[model samples]
Target chain A: MRYDIRFSGSGGQGIITAGILLAQAAAIKAGKNAVQSQSYGPEARGGASKAEVIISDDEINYPKIISPDIVISLTQEAYNKYAVDLKDEAVIIVDNTLVHEYKQDGHKVYAVPITASVKELLGSAVSANIATLGVVNEICKIMEHQWLLDVVISNFPERAAENNTKAYNLGIDLAKKVME
Target chain B: MEKKRERKFLQGNDAVALGALYAGCKFYAGYPITPSTEVAERLAAWLPKNGGRFIQMEDEISAMAAVIGASLAGKKSLTATSGPGMSLKLENLGYGYMAEVPCVVLNVMRGGPSTGTPTGPGQADIMQARWGTHGDHPCIALTPSTVYEQFSQTVRAFNLAEKYRMPVIILSDEIIGHMREAIEVPLEGELEVIEREKPACAIDEYKPYDNSVLVPKMASFGQGYRYHVTGLNHDEYGFPTNSAKLIGLQEERLIKKVEENYDDIVQVEHFMCEDAEHIIFAFGSSARASKDAVLNLRKKGVKAGLLKPLTIWPFPDREISEYASKVKDITVVELSVGQSVREVSRAAGGRCNIKHIYKVDSKPISPVDIEKAVEG
Candidate 1:
């Protein structure tokens, strides 16, 4: 099975880091083939930035996503840009607090208050990328939950670890509640 | 006993730095550019920790000069840059060629003629890599299609440079340079690392440009064997010689060394070509998509195959000609407007029909793109 996932947001939002962490969980932790790549404008921040990950049981030949099976959009601009042209059954997880407008288009759309909830619970929305990963895993089950958690913890410093963990768990809970 | 290897998720640029370290690279001098900057970044942090030297030169020209200088000083040296920086380093790159300074110059290509797209991919540098420095000099360039090859081929690039005593180029695109994948980095002693041969003769008998042998033994500056290194045509004694015969001989030896060693220096990958009637000629990132297209074509019973040249410069003319003799058609796929297609036409020698799929919009050619071109 192959899963093509794209994370889109403004620069400095850690969208690229989220995609990398997902790929790391698949390749290093789950022992599967994975490739992660990103593209951003010249601007260091505020530009539309995107990171893509392809996870596969077989060897992945084409590194880029031909048609995304899953997309996580943290901004309305990103949503408007990437959330279209996806597979008919593609799953989309958008930050409801930030992405105010989106087209459902028969695809599974989980509009969760990702950034707002993280800010309310952890006093900062910096961990919203990690929370998005949690929501993605809950919806897609691309890898084991523990594998992703381990990979996420390894990426953060000791001080930020607890908050990121809380954000991740909060994402899973948000996805669970939305699915219900 | 088999050596233990470590597996980790590595970006292509990071892998190149690690491969250089594994191959005993001790010095890095480069002006960082997009797509290739990670290579310099990794080497900058790692080289000092490993008793090596790293310098962020004022510009690309100085960076190339510093690498040549470091290599002449008996250190395995390297520098990485993208298209624009590569253009700046060409003059010194030519100097390295004329002076026979062994160093690795990596060009992680981006869309270009003049800063076309700083963060996008392009293969237009294939020809630039061959003729970018000018003159009738021979070139050695390696193109890696995957992150693993980025590591292994970088080690090979250093090996080829040290063994051949020339400036070897690694032609990577933005995709391969930045893409991250899992790779098993070779343990030390697993991969053969070639160090330049030291002079075996007495100090008095030493000639830095000794043409008696295919490759002369090099002595470091401080090692007491003094010699003149210049871009000018020089005689066997390393001094500028106006003698026509000496200049002719000097040029002949430089070209002949690589030409005679073509078998050893050239590397190409042939996939499902045994009975293929149509072949896709590609390299670097385009080869990845072509491989997928070939597999997809095979499933549909189309006789499509892929010829990926790992060694881009010595241009696998002989191999392509052999395939062209039997193939009905050859389609050259690249991410540039059109670069490798010219080489493909020359190599095919009109034995078969040649088609090309070129994309210069700073976007990669997808597998679907290749499949559509082939199926149509």
Candidate 2:
């Protein structure tokens, strides 16, 4: 399957890193080919940020995600801006606390309480992106959750390895408990 | 047979650094610039530990100068920067051009007239890259569209720079510089590496600027072979010359060295253009989208194709004309308002109908844009 996913948020929320780790999981651990590209406004720290990942079983010619199969927005600005370009059957994932308003008219929508879940489960929202990754993995099935864990541990700092792994598992639990 | 290697996911900038290291690059001096600072950052992290030197120069001009100095001292050297920095580097780039110092300069382009959009992607430097420096001199520039090409092309850039004893520019935009993708890269020893030829003649017989063989063999300063190297027009013995014959000879050889080997240096990838009518000529990020546009058009019962120039400079005019001769229409898609389209028009030479699909708002030209342009 060719899955085109976009992770949109304000910078420093690690959305770009999230997209990169996801592609690494698909390509390195899942044995699928993937391409991840990102763009940010001039004000890199607080500006609107977007990272696109395309994972395919076959060769990927276009390395960009023009018409997204899935859109995960962690901010109202990101959600409102990117919602119009979603695929007809796209799965829209949003952080309920941050993105209070969303329009997912033609497709499956999951308003995940990503910030609150990370706060309750991990004791801090620092790894909020990792927790959101778990929610997306559970719904989209882009790659195995185990593969995501492996990517986070290998790519992230050694000290945060244990907590990040816990963060991912907590996300999976949240996804199953709430979205089910 | 070439030994195959395992594939790994890597960012484009990291791939360039790895390729430089694998190609025996031992010196890196650069000023930080957006979309390109990662190239220097990666080199800084790995270069020193692997028997290389990484220096952060005060500015782009100093960075270019340091790379030239290091290369002349017989080390494979590289320097990376973005649009404004590249502009600041034009004088020294011209110095490297005239002095014929073997080095690689990476311009990981971001949008800019003067810091237009630092993090945004644009192909605005196509003309600046080829003509940024004063006066006319032939340049060798390569644009890699994928992470695999980013790695392999950087190695190729080193090989070309050393073989010709001139600076080679790796003109990568933000799209390829920052994108992360899975690439099958051969290990250090697996890739074929080329080193600059050392002079075999006696110390007294050496002529650093000798026009006899076009690319005269060079010996580093400490190697005991002493010779003069001035930016002014020089003679066979590297002495400044006012004689018209010597000036003409020096200018001719500087351009001829790369131009004569154009066949070997120029490379392009054709996507289903063998028997197509509408040809989309693209490079860098535009080529990636154009490839998808070509595939989509074929599925729509249209005979659309693409020609992606991996080697951007020297223009690959012969091949562009060869394929353009049979095509009914040619569309040049580039990120700039219009830069690469000029080269396409010049190469197509009025044999076919030429059209332009350009975007200069710092937004990437998606495949849908190209498809719509072709359908219209």
Please report the candidate that would top lDDT against the real structure. Answer: 1
Q: Candidate 2 chain B: minimum summed lDDT over ten consecutive residues — where?
A: B183-192
Top TM-score hit: 1
Model 2 interface RMSD, in angstroms?
1.2
Among residues 3 or more apart in sequence or in different chains, the pairs in candidate 1 whose N, CA or C atoms overlap within 3 Å are none
Residue A13, candidate 2: alpha-carbon lDDT:
88
Clashes in model 2: which pairs? none
State each model's C-alpha RMSD to the native.
Answer: 1.1, 1.7
Angstrom error at residue B156, model 1: 0.6
Best DockQ goes to which candidate?
A: 1
DockQ-based class of model 2? high
